[model samples]
Structures are given as structure tokens and as C-alpha cells.
Target: MTLTLEERVRLFGSPIPEGFTVRVVESGTVINDEIVSDTKVVANGYDLYMTDKVFETMRDKCLSKTSKVWGEAKS
Candidate 1:
């Protein structure tokens, strides 16, 4: 089964705060070359009405960028 953004965030030891919402900007891949476990998510509100500055501020405080590039980076 596919995991939600909250579950994936918990995998990294950072859970988003209450009243904050996020959506997947780019779905993660499970391929050989790029094994991105966590998707690219943005701090958009529940109805996608959050402003950029507020979203960015919350994202910076709550989330982190996840990447798992193989070969040179994944060694």
C-alpha cells in the first residue's frame, strides 16, 4: 500500500504540527537509479489557500528535503 505524506514524514522523525497540511508536489519513485522514499511535499493548507511566505516558513521549520540518489550520492 502507498504511504501518506504524514506517514513518510514520521519516518524521518519529524511530524507536522496540528492545523498544518501538506500535499505531494511530486510523487516519489521506487526505481533503481533514484530511490526516493519520501515524496516532494509542499506546505499548502487543507484547501490550498496558504500563502507562499507562510508555507515556506512552516516548511522550513517542520519539514526537510529527502533524496536517495544511487551511485555517486548513495554510496
Candidate 2:
């Protein structure tokens, strides 16, 4: 199903209750050394996964300054 940007944002950005955090994982990555994987956010007793396309787009657009800083810090 094709969702509008507003809908997508609403669906993905809704806040979880206190004492919970979102877990984001990329597709095709292993968790605990297992091949089969699912990417989702678990928070406040809820589990959610953004669509693959959305996840990829967001990941690609995210700033890497933190990673660059970490690399520089390590050097």
C-alpha cells in the first residue's frame, strides 16, 4: 500500500511511552549471528517496522557526522 508522506511520518514518528526505546535494524544484517532478520522498533510494548524503501531512504539521508567524529576521535 502506498501511504502519503504525512501518513508515513505519523505512523513512524509517533512517540512511545516512557521507559521504552526504539530499535532500528537494517535489512540483510545479522542479529546475534543469525541470518534471518527482521527490522523493527520495540518500545512501550509495541513493535513496529518501517517499510524497506522508507528505511533505506532515511538511512541514506542521515548525516554521518557522528560516525566521522567517532573515527576522528579514534585516530
Candidate 3:
């Protein structure tokens, strides 16, 4: 099922998955390209955005750092 940004956000806090750190860069604009005048602006009409580089880095870290020891122990 396709999950909307709000639904996903409800299911998972931020765009960054659990157990990982995310570095968000404020481009001073919303994901829809609207200029943000205030830092207090919540993600009302916008989705939390991140650069491709950040996404890739998080993905790589999660994949590489997953423990294989749990599987070994189970077996």
C-alpha cells in the first residue's frame, strides 16, 4: 500500500528510520520549494526533506552495520 507523508510520519517519526541518526540541512525552503520565513514552521503542507547524499549514507550505514551475530546465535 502506498503511504502518504503524514501516514508515514505517524508510523515512523521522521524520514530517518529508528536507531539511526539523521543530519538535516535547512535549505530555507519546504519540500515543495516554498520559502520558509520562520524556523518554527512545522511540516504542515510539506514533507520533511533530505538530500540524496544523506539518504545514501544512512542506507549504507544501516546495511553495513546490521549485526549478523543475532542470526548466528539463532542458528
Off by over 4 Å in 3: 1-46, 67-75
In candidate 3, position 1 carries an lDDT of 82
Give the alpha carbon lDDT tens digit for every residue of 1-75 in model 3: 875544444566343446554335454645455544334322433344454455565455443333231232211
lDDT string for model 2 (1-75, tens) is: 875444443455323333444455555544444432344432224533444554555554332332342343312
Clashes of each: 0, 0, 0
TM-score, model 1 to reference? 0.25
Q: What are the RMSDs of all candidates, in order?
A: 15.3, 10.6, 10.4
**Pairs that clash in candidate 3:** none
Per-residue CA lDDT of candidate 1, range 13-75, in tens? Answer: 344545554433333433334433243233323422333444565465444333221112321
Evaluated at residue 25, the lDDT of candidate 3 is 47
Q: Could you arrange the candidates by lDDT from highest to lowest? A: 3, 2, 1
Residue 65 in candidate 1, Cα distance off native in Å = 11
Quick one: RMSD of model 1? 15.3
